[model samples]
Target: MNAAPADQIRLLDVQAFDVRLQQLAHRRKSLPEHTEIQSLTKDLTQMRDLLVAAQTEESDCAREQTKAEQDVDQVRTRAARDQQRLDSGAVTSPKDLAGLQHEITSLAKRQGDLEDVVLEVMERRESAQERVAELTERVSSVQAKADDAVARRDAACEELDGEAASVAKEREVVAGVVPADLIALYDKLRAQQGGIGAAKLYQRTCQGCRQELAITELAEIRSAAPDTVVRCENCRRILVRTSESGL
Candidate 1:
């Protein structure tokens, strides 16, 4: 609204700066590292769950092995006492000798069964231990990858932050030169048009929509007072014409 020719051109710089800032922000959000970090975070959670399950299984196996060992020791102790009694030959009655012999045979069978169970428990314990080890290693690997992804994401954000900061400074400097009403209009339009309020008019084409202007529209735009702000017919974006526009 009533901006001088030079002022209108300067407003283009402000619009350009805003557009660049928007692009930078979009790039920051869409970085490949961001997606990768998200995926890695999910994987880390799964790995942690697997590690916990493996550790629990390992603990259960250890407990079973301990109980099996205790059973073996108890059976062995009973068998030793029985052997001592048999060797001493203290039993004189035939019935008593037969009972002792039968008791010894039952004890021997129990000892063999307990030994086999103990061996099986030991094997299961070993397998459980191996699973725990594998899970530990896998969790560590996922953690390392997640850490790397975080670092990469941080670096990318830092770069974008720096670029946005510089552009913000430039935008502020340009804002001081543009009229308040024009800036207000640009801000409102930017909010409505997805952060792009202005486009360069090149060879009668609206850069925003990449569409050619009608002959009558082009003539009116070219003949209009330089101080008047023009909106593209196709895209409704503020058209800033320059020498490079070939208009």
Candidate 2:
């Protein structure tokens, strides 16, 4: 396939735009914020799980403390009733009075033990609450970081998309001027060759593969017509000749 010299040069412009678009796409994918967000998301998941566990523990502790306090209250009430009975002359028999006093003493001990249980439960609940608070703060902090990373990633993508849009439009316009056959061939070669369908023959080297054309290759290229589409033997990419192409 052959295209005019100017058309071939325009193909280079098209290639440049394509290269820029490729770079923009790569930059968008490889944004540092992407990795940062990923890592932060993992941390956030772990933190959220821990927060949930802590909250569950706190809730359980709260219920336990309530139950313990209720037990203490019940024991205290029983002890108070027994003491009242003992102080009054309700038990007229001396043996009955002694039994009542003994019963009161046992109730007092039971109340004290229940109260100690309440205190222990209170301490555990307090610890659980502190853990919940700490976990909550950590979750919030990680969530904030994740949010920030997401924002940054979005902003970067927006910027890159805008630039890519502009470049793509320009590529469309530039490619419009080239011959359909040449464009088709270039597209096919580009797909086959790592995004580069055409390259400049600078000095004596094929820019696509960075290989210097052999003497015979240069001789043939030098003899080819100006409008002839020549491909580099080394890379099989269209070699656009310029004045600097040291024939």
On TM-score, the candidate that comes out on top is 2
lDDT of 1 by residue, 1-247 (tens): 6678777788778888988898999999999988888898898898888888878888988898889889989988998898889889888789988988898899899989998998998898888889889888988898898899889989989999999999999999989978899888888888888787878888778887899889899889878888889998887888888886666
Report every candidate's CA lDDT.
0.86, 0.91
Off by over 4 Å in 1: 244-247
Off by over 4 Å in 2: none
Query: Which RMSD values do the candidates have, in order?
Result: 1.9, 1.4
- Candidate 2 has a TM-score of 0.95
All candidates' TM-scores? 0.91, 0.95
Clashing residue pairs, backbone N/CA/C < 3 A, model 1: none
